[model samples]
Target: MLKVNKLNKSFGENKVLNDISFELKSGEIGVLLGKSGTGKTTILRCINGLEEFDRGEITVDDISIKNVKDINKIRNKTGMVFQNFNLFPHMSVLENIIQAPISVAKISKEEAVNTAKKLLKLVDLEDKINSYPFELSGGQKQRVAIARACALTPKVLCFDEPTSALDAESIKKVINIINELKNKKIAILIITHDIGFANEIGDKIINI
Candidate 1:
Protein backbone atom coordinates (compact mmCIF):
# COMPACT_ATOMS: atom_id res chain seq x y z
CA MET A 1 0.00 0.00 0.00
CA LEU A 2 3.03 2.23 0.29
CA LYS A 3 5.94 2.70 -2.10
CA VAL A 4 9.08 4.84 -2.09
CA ASN A 5 11.27 5.21 -5.14
CA LYS A 6 14.69 6.84 -5.51
CA LEU A 7 14.14 8.72 -2.26
CA ASN A 8 16.77 11.30 -1.37
CA LYS A 9 17.04 13.88 1.41
CA SER A 10 19.64 16.29 2.82
CA PHE A 11 20.24 18.79 5.56
CA GLY A 12 22.04 21.77 4.01
CA GLU A 13 25.19 20.15 2.56
CA ASN A 14 24.86 16.89 4.40
CA LYS A 15 22.94 14.17 2.60
CA VAL A 16 21.01 11.88 4.94
CA LEU A 17 18.99 9.49 2.76
CA ASN A 18 20.59 8.44 -0.52
CA ASP A 19 18.62 6.81 -3.28
CA ILE A 20 16.55 4.85 -0.76
CA SER A 21 13.73 2.77 -2.19
CA PHE A 22 11.23 0.22 -0.88
CA GLU A 23 7.63 -0.98 -0.98
CA LEU A 24 5.30 -2.20 1.76
CA LYS A 25 2.15 -4.11 0.97
CA SER A 26 -0.98 -4.36 3.03
CA GLY A 27 -0.59 -6.55 6.15
CA GLU A 28 3.19 -6.66 5.71
CA ILE A 29 5.73 -5.32 8.17
CA GLY A 30 8.71 -3.45 6.73
CA VAL A 31 11.74 -2.50 8.78
CA LEU A 32 14.34 0.18 8.11
CA LEU A 33 17.43 -1.16 9.81
CA GLY A 34 20.79 0.55 10.20
CA LYS A 35 23.04 2.49 12.57
CA SER A 36 22.05 5.79 14.21
CA GLY A 37 23.05 8.09 11.34
CA THR A 38 21.58 5.97 8.54
CA GLY A 39 18.50 8.15 7.99
CA LYS A 40 15.93 5.57 8.97
CA THR A 41 13.76 8.04 10.84
CA THR A 42 14.19 10.57 8.02
CA ILE A 43 12.51 8.16 5.63
CA LEU A 44 9.53 7.82 7.98
CA ARG A 45 9.33 11.62 8.36
CA CYS A 46 9.39 12.03 4.60
CA ILE A 47 6.56 9.53 4.21
CA ASN A 48 4.52 11.19 6.95
CA GLY A 49 4.92 14.68 5.38
CA LEU A 50 6.83 15.93 8.45
CA GLU A 51 9.93 16.49 6.26
CA GLU A 52 10.34 17.49 2.63
CA PHE A 53 12.57 15.34 0.49
CA ASP A 54 14.63 16.87 -2.25
CA ARG A 55 14.01 14.04 -4.68
CA GLY A 56 11.93 10.88 -5.17
CA GLU A 57 8.36 9.77 -4.73
CA ILE A 58 6.23 8.34 -1.92
CA THR A 59 2.75 7.06 -2.61
CA VAL A 60 0.28 5.79 -0.04
CA ASP A 61 -2.59 3.88 -1.62
CA ASP A 62 -1.74 5.72 -4.87
CA ILE A 63 -1.93 9.21 -3.31
CA SER A 64 1.33 11.08 -3.94
CA ILE A 65 3.03 12.81 -1.04
CA LYS A 66 4.44 15.38 -3.50
CA ASN A 67 1.03 16.99 -3.71
CA VAL A 68 1.31 19.43 -0.83
CA LYS A 69 -2.37 20.22 -0.84
CA ASP A 70 -3.21 16.59 -0.15
CA ILE A 71 -0.75 16.25 2.73
CA ASN A 72 -3.56 15.76 5.17
CA LYS A 73 -5.09 13.12 2.91
CA ILE A 74 -1.80 11.25 2.93
CA ARG A 75 -1.49 11.61 6.70
CA ASN A 76 -4.99 10.32 7.28
CA LYS A 77 -3.90 7.08 5.67
CA THR A 78 -0.63 6.90 7.61
CA GLY A 79 -0.16 6.79 11.39
CA MET A 80 3.15 7.35 13.17
CA VAL A 81 4.31 6.23 16.61
CA PHE A 82 7.31 8.30 17.61
CA GLN A 83 10.50 7.08 19.32
CA ASN A 84 9.35 9.02 22.33
CA PHE A 85 5.69 8.31 23.01
CA ASN A 86 4.21 11.73 22.18
CA LEU A 87 1.17 11.52 24.44
CA PHE A 88 -0.37 14.61 25.97
CA PRO A 89 0.95 14.55 29.55
CA HIS A 90 -2.16 16.10 31.04
CA MET A 91 -4.72 14.02 29.16
CA SER A 92 -5.89 10.65 30.33
CA VAL A 93 -5.11 7.58 28.21
CA LEU A 94 -8.64 7.50 26.84
CA GLU A 95 -8.51 11.17 25.94
CA ASN A 96 -5.20 10.80 24.17
CA ILE A 97 -6.52 7.94 22.05
CA ILE A 98 -9.74 9.68 21.10
CA GLN A 99 -8.31 13.11 20.24
CA ALA A 100 -7.29 12.28 16.66
CA PRO A 101 -10.47 10.42 15.84
CA ILE A 102 -12.60 13.29 17.02
CA SER A 103 -10.47 16.12 15.61
CA VAL A 104 -9.22 14.55 12.39
CA ALA A 105 -11.79 11.92 11.56
CA LYS A 106 -14.68 14.08 12.66
CA ILE A 107 -16.17 11.27 14.71
CA SER A 108 -18.53 12.09 17.55
CA LYS A 109 -17.16 12.17 21.07
CA GLU A 110 -19.28 9.22 22.21
CA GLU A 111 -18.22 7.09 19.24
CA ALA A 112 -14.57 8.06 19.64
CA VAL A 113 -14.67 7.09 23.29
CA ASN A 114 -16.17 3.71 22.43
CA THR A 115 -13.46 3.12 19.80
CA ALA A 116 -10.80 4.27 22.24
CA LYS A 117 -11.98 1.77 24.82
CA LYS A 118 -11.69 -1.08 22.33
CA LEU A 119 -8.17 0.04 21.37
CA LEU A 120 -7.19 0.32 25.00
CA LYS A 121 -8.34 -3.23 25.53
CA LEU A 122 -6.33 -4.36 22.53
CA VAL A 123 -3.19 -2.77 24.00
CA ASP A 124 -3.92 -4.30 27.40
CA LEU A 125 -4.44 -0.85 28.89
CA GLU A 126 -8.19 -0.82 29.44
CA ASP A 127 -7.66 -0.24 33.16
CA LYS A 128 -5.44 2.74 32.43
CA ILE A 129 -8.22 4.57 30.64
CA ASN A 130 -8.20 7.33 33.20
CA SER A 131 -4.45 7.27 33.90
CA TYR A 132 -2.14 10.12 32.94
CA PRO A 133 1.13 9.71 31.07
CA PHE A 134 3.22 10.33 34.18
CA GLU A 135 1.44 7.49 35.95
CA LEU A 136 2.40 4.91 33.36
CA SER A 137 5.63 3.09 32.67
CA GLY A 138 7.59 3.44 29.42
CA GLY A 139 5.99 0.35 27.90
CA GLN A 140 2.49 1.38 28.94
CA LYS A 141 3.05 4.80 27.40
CA GLN A 142 4.21 3.23 24.16
CA ARG A 143 1.16 0.98 24.07
CA VAL A 144 -1.01 4.04 24.64
CA ALA A 145 0.76 5.68 21.74
CA ILE A 146 0.00 2.65 19.60
CA ALA A 147 -3.69 2.84 20.54
CA ARG A 148 -3.67 6.52 19.69
CA ALA A 149 -2.18 5.80 16.28
CA CYS A 150 -4.77 3.11 15.56
CA ALA A 151 -7.56 5.48 16.55
CA LEU A 152 -7.22 7.01 13.09
CA THR A 153 -7.67 3.62 11.43
CA PRO A 154 -4.64 4.26 9.24
CA LYS A 155 -3.67 1.94 6.44
CA VAL A 156 0.04 2.37 7.05
CA LEU A 157 1.59 2.62 10.52
CA CYS A 158 5.14 3.86 10.98
CA PHE A 159 6.97 3.30 14.23
CA ASP A 160 10.22 5.16 14.86
CA GLU A 161 12.61 3.21 17.10
CA PRO A 162 9.67 1.64 18.91
CA THR A 163 11.71 -0.52 21.25
CA SER A 164 14.55 1.92 21.82
CA ALA A 165 13.48 2.81 25.35
CA LEU A 166 11.97 -0.45 26.55
CA ASP A 167 13.45 -3.25 28.65
CA ALA A 168 13.56 -6.87 27.42
CA GLU A 169 10.13 -7.82 28.76
CA SER A 170 8.59 -4.55 27.70
CA ILE A 171 10.11 -4.91 24.26
CA LYS A 172 8.50 -8.30 23.96
CA LYS A 173 5.11 -6.87 24.82
CA VAL A 174 5.53 -4.07 22.30
CA ILE A 175 6.57 -6.49 19.59
CA ASN A 176 3.56 -8.65 20.32
CA ILE A 177 1.25 -5.66 19.99
CA ILE A 178 2.87 -4.78 16.66
CA ASN A 179 2.54 -8.34 15.43
CA GLU A 180 -1.17 -8.31 16.16
CA LEU A 181 -1.58 -5.28 13.89
CA LYS A 182 -0.78 -7.34 10.80
CA ASN A 183 -4.10 -9.12 11.21
CA LYS A 184 -5.79 -5.76 10.86
CA LYS A 185 -4.19 -5.36 7.40
CA ILE A 186 -2.18 -2.28 8.37
CA ALA A 187 1.13 -1.93 6.55
CA ILE A 188 3.65 -1.52 9.36
CA LEU A 189 7.00 0.24 8.94
CA ILE A 190 9.38 0.14 11.85
CA ILE A 191 12.64 2.08 11.96
CA THR A 192 15.03 0.58 14.48
CA HIS A 193 18.64 -0.44 15.12
CA ASP A 194 17.58 -3.43 17.18
CA ILE A 195 18.32 -6.32 14.85
CA GLY A 196 16.79 -8.93 17.11
CA PHE A 197 13.54 -7.04 17.48
CA ALA A 198 13.40 -6.29 13.76
CA ASN A 199 13.96 -9.92 12.90
CA GLU A 200 11.13 -10.91 15.17
CA ILE A 201 8.52 -8.64 13.60
CA GLY A 202 9.72 -7.50 10.17
CA ASP A 203 8.53 -9.33 7.07
CA LYS A 204 11.03 -7.35 5.02
CA ILE A 205 13.97 -5.16 6.05
CA ILE A 206 15.23 -2.15 4.10
CA ASN A 207 18.82 -1.39 5.04
CA ILE A 208 19.69 2.27 4.78
Candidate 2:
Protein backbone atom coordinates (compact mmCIF):
# COMPACT_ATOMS: atom_id res chain seq x y z
CA MET A 1 0.00 0.00 0.00
CA LEU A 2 3.09 2.21 0.25
CA LYS A 3 5.82 2.68 -2.35
CA VAL A 4 9.01 4.75 -2.45
CA ASN A 5 11.04 4.70 -5.64
CA LYS A 6 14.36 6.29 -6.55
CA LEU A 7 14.08 8.49 -3.53
CA ASN A 8 16.86 11.01 -3.18
CA LYS A 9 17.26 13.84 -0.71
CA SER A 10 20.05 16.18 0.33
CA PHE A 11 20.72 19.11 2.59
CA GLY A 12 22.76 21.64 0.57
CA GLU A 13 25.67 19.51 -0.72
CA ASN A 14 25.41 16.58 1.70
CA LYS A 15 23.27 13.77 0.36
CA VAL A 16 21.19 11.73 2.79
CA LEU A 17 18.88 9.33 0.98
CA ASN A 18 20.03 8.25 -2.46
CA ASP A 19 18.02 6.20 -4.89
CA ILE A 20 16.19 4.36 -2.11
CA SER A 21 13.38 2.12 -3.24
CA PHE A 22 10.96 -0.05 -1.26
CA GLU A 23 7.42 -1.35 -1.25
CA LEU A 24 5.39 -2.10 1.86
CA LYS A 25 2.14 -3.93 1.27
CA SER A 26 -0.92 -4.27 3.45
CA GLY A 27 -0.47 -6.54 6.49
CA GLU A 28 3.32 -6.40 6.04
CA ILE A 29 5.87 -4.86 8.37
CA GLY A 30 8.85 -3.29 6.60
CA VAL A 31 11.79 -2.28 8.78
CA LEU A 32 14.37 0.35 7.81
CA LEU A 33 17.44 -0.60 9.81
CA GLY A 34 20.59 1.49 9.93
CA LYS A 35 22.87 3.41 12.20
CA SER A 36 22.34 7.07 13.09
CA GLY A 37 22.51 9.57 10.18
CA THR A 38 21.66 6.90 7.63
CA GLY A 39 18.52 8.73 6.46
CA LYS A 40 16.20 6.12 7.96
CA THR A 41 14.21 8.78 9.76
CA THR A 42 14.57 11.05 6.75
CA ILE A 43 12.71 8.44 4.74
CA LEU A 44 9.87 8.56 7.22
CA ARG A 45 9.77 12.36 7.09
CA CYS A 46 9.58 12.30 3.31
CA ILE A 47 6.82 9.70 3.29
CA ASN A 48 4.76 11.65 5.79
CA GLY A 49 5.19 14.94 3.85
CA LEU A 50 7.11 16.52 6.72
CA GLU A 51 10.13 16.91 4.39
CA GLU A 52 10.15 17.33 0.67
CA PHE A 53 12.58 15.12 -1.20
CA ASP A 54 14.81 16.44 -3.97
CA ARG A 55 14.02 13.50 -6.21
CA GLY A 56 11.75 10.47 -6.01
CA GLU A 57 8.19 9.32 -5.76
CA ILE A 58 6.33 8.39 -2.58
CA THR A 59 2.79 7.18 -2.56
CA VAL A 60 0.68 6.01 0.38
CA ASP A 61 -2.27 3.94 -0.69
CA ASP A 62 -2.88 5.63 -4.06
CA ILE A 63 -2.08 9.23 -3.07
CA SER A 64 1.23 10.62 -4.25
CA ILE A 65 2.91 12.81 -1.70
CA LYS A 66 4.13 15.27 -4.33
CA ASN A 67 1.08 15.53 -6.52
CA VAL A 68 -1.49 16.17 -3.82
CA LYS A 69 -2.61 19.80 -3.73
CA ASP A 70 -3.36 19.34 -0.06
CA ILE A 71 -0.74 17.50 1.96
CA ASN A 72 -3.43 16.42 4.39
CA LYS A 73 -4.76 14.06 1.74
CA ILE A 74 -1.60 11.98 1.93
CA ARG A 75 -1.33 12.48 5.66
CA ASN A 76 -4.87 11.22 6.22
CA LYS A 77 -3.87 7.96 4.56
CA THR A 78 -0.80 7.54 6.79
CA GLY A 79 -0.16 7.63 10.53
CA MET A 80 3.16 8.49 12.15
CA VAL A 81 4.30 7.59 15.66
CA PHE A 82 7.39 9.55 16.56
CA GLN A 83 10.27 8.36 18.71
CA ASN A 84 9.49 10.85 21.47
CA PHE A 85 5.76 10.13 21.48
CA ASN A 86 4.84 13.70 20.53
CA LEU A 87 1.72 13.96 22.66
CA PHE A 88 0.18 17.30 23.51
CA PRO A 89 1.31 17.99 27.04
CA HIS A 90 -1.75 20.14 27.76
CA MET A 91 -4.35 17.64 26.56
CA SER A 92 -5.56 14.51 28.28
CA VAL A 93 -4.95 11.12 26.66
CA LEU A 94 -8.55 10.92 25.46
CA GLU A 95 -8.41 14.47 24.13
CA ASN A 96 -5.17 13.86 22.29
CA ILE A 97 -6.55 10.80 20.49
CA ILE A 98 -9.83 12.42 19.58
CA GLN A 99 -8.29 15.70 18.39
CA ALA A 100 -7.30 14.61 14.90
CA PRO A 101 -10.50 12.77 14.15
CA ILE A 102 -12.76 15.53 15.32
CA SER A 103 -10.71 18.39 13.91
CA VAL A 104 -9.34 17.03 10.64
CA ALA A 105 -11.80 14.25 9.88
CA LYS A 106 -14.74 16.44 10.94
CA ILE A 107 -16.27 13.63 12.98
CA SER A 108 -18.59 14.49 15.84
CA LYS A 109 -17.17 14.71 19.36
CA GLU A 110 -19.24 11.70 20.44
CA GLU A 111 -17.96 9.63 17.52
CA ALA A 112 -14.39 10.70 18.11
CA VAL A 113 -14.66 9.83 21.79
CA ASN A 114 -16.04 6.40 20.97
CA THR A 115 -13.21 5.75 18.52
CA ALA A 116 -10.65 7.03 21.00
CA LYS A 117 -11.97 4.69 23.68
CA LYS A 118 -11.66 1.72 21.36
CA LEU A 119 -8.09 2.77 20.43
CA LEU A 120 -7.11 3.28 24.06
CA LYS A 121 -8.49 -0.17 24.84
CA LEU A 122 -6.47 -1.57 21.95
CA VAL A 123 -3.30 -0.02 23.39
CA ASP A 124 -4.20 -1.26 26.87
CA LEU A 125 -4.47 2.30 28.15
CA GLU A 126 -8.21 2.50 28.82
CA ASP A 127 -7.75 3.46 32.45
CA LYS A 128 -5.34 6.22 31.54
CA ILE A 129 -7.88 7.98 29.39
CA ASN A 130 -8.07 10.98 31.66
CA SER A 131 -4.31 11.14 32.27
CA TYR A 132 -2.01 13.78 30.80
CA PRO A 133 1.27 13.11 29.04
CA PHE A 134 3.30 14.20 32.07
CA GLU A 135 1.46 11.77 34.34
CA LEU A 136 2.25 8.73 32.22
CA SER A 137 5.41 6.65 31.87
CA GLY A 138 7.42 6.52 28.67
CA GLY A 139 5.66 3.36 27.55
CA GLN A 140 2.25 4.73 28.38
CA LYS A 141 2.98 7.88 26.42
CA GLN A 142 4.05 5.85 23.41
CA ARG A 143 0.89 3.78 23.59
CA VAL A 144 -1.16 6.96 23.70
CA ALA A 145 0.68 8.25 20.65
CA ILE A 146 -0.11 5.03 18.84
CA ALA A 147 -3.78 5.37 19.74
CA ARG A 148 -3.84 8.94 18.50
CA ALA A 149 -2.32 7.92 15.20
CA CYS A 150 -4.79 5.09 14.77
CA ALA A 151 -7.65 7.41 15.56
CA LEU A 152 -7.49 8.64 11.98
CA THR A 153 -7.91 5.09 10.62
CA PRO A 154 -4.93 5.45 8.28
CA LYS A 155 -4.17 2.87 5.63
CA VAL A 156 -0.43 2.98 6.39
CA LEU A 157 1.43 3.48 9.68
CA CYS A 158 4.99 4.78 10.10
CA PHE A 159 6.95 4.50 13.33
CA ASP A 160 10.23 6.27 14.04
CA GLU A 161 12.39 4.41 16.55
CA PRO A 162 9.44 2.91 18.42
CA THR A 163 11.58 1.07 20.98
CA SER A 164 14.01 3.90 21.58
CA ALA A 165 13.41 4.82 25.24
CA LEU A 166 11.42 1.81 26.46
CA ASP A 167 12.59 -1.09 28.59
CA ALA A 168 12.63 -4.75 27.49
CA GLU A 169 9.08 -5.37 28.69
CA SER A 170 7.81 -2.22 27.01
CA ILE A 171 9.54 -3.21 23.81
CA LYS A 172 7.70 -6.51 23.89
CA LYS A 173 4.42 -4.69 24.38
CA VAL A 174 5.12 -2.52 21.35
CA ILE A 175 5.98 -5.61 19.33
CA ASN A 176 2.68 -7.18 20.24
CA ILE A 177 0.76 -4.03 19.44
CA ILE A 178 2.49 -3.74 16.05
CA ASN A 179 1.74 -7.38 15.33
CA GLU A 180 -1.91 -6.79 16.08
CA LEU A 181 -1.89 -3.81 13.69
CA LYS A 182 -0.45 -5.98 10.94
CA ASN A 183 -3.42 -8.27 11.27
CA LYS A 184 -5.62 -5.26 10.67
CA LYS A 185 -3.94 -4.90 7.26
CA ILE A 186 -2.25 -1.58 7.95
CA ALA A 187 0.98 -1.35 5.98
CA ILE A 188 3.67 -0.73 8.59
CA LEU A 189 7.08 0.94 8.19
CA ILE A 190 9.37 1.01 11.19
CA ILE A 191 12.63 2.97 11.43
CA THR A 192 14.63 1.33 14.19
CA HIS A 193 18.27 0.83 15.12
CA ASP A 194 17.38 -2.33 17.02
CA ILE A 195 18.30 -5.18 14.73
CA GLY A 196 16.88 -7.80 17.05
CA PHE A 197 13.55 -6.05 17.24
CA ALA A 198 13.50 -5.58 13.47
CA ASN A 199 14.26 -9.24 12.84
CA GLU A 200 11.52 -10.31 15.18
CA ILE A 201 8.77 -8.20 13.64
CA GLY A 202 9.81 -7.14 10.13
CA ASP A 203 8.45 -9.08 7.16
CA LYS A 204 11.13 -7.37 5.03
CA ILE A 205 14.23 -5.77 6.53
CA ILE A 206 15.93 -3.05 4.48
CA ASN A 207 19.42 -1.91 5.36
CA ILE A 208 20.54 1.58 4.42
Q: What TM-score would you give candidate 2 relative to the actual structure?
A: 0.96
TM-score of each: 0.96, 0.96
lDDT of 2 by residue, 1-208 (tens): 9999889999999899999999999999999988889899888888877887887788878876653235676888889999998999999999999998988889999999999999988899999999999999999999999999899888889999999899999999999999999999999999988889989999999888
lDDT at 33, model 1 = 81
The deviation in Å at residue 119 for candidate 2 is 0.4
Q: lDDT per prediction?
A: 0.89, 0.90
What C-alpha lDDT does candidate 2 achieve relative to the native structure? 0.90
Worst 10 residues of 1 by lDDT: 64-73
Clashing residue pairs in candidate 1 are: none
**Model 1, span 1-208: residue lDDT tens:** 8999888888999999888889999999998888788788888888888888888878898877654445776888999999998999989999999888898789999999999999998899999999999999999999999999999888899999998899998998888888889988899999988888888899998888
Candidate 1's C-alpha runs over 4 A off are 67-69
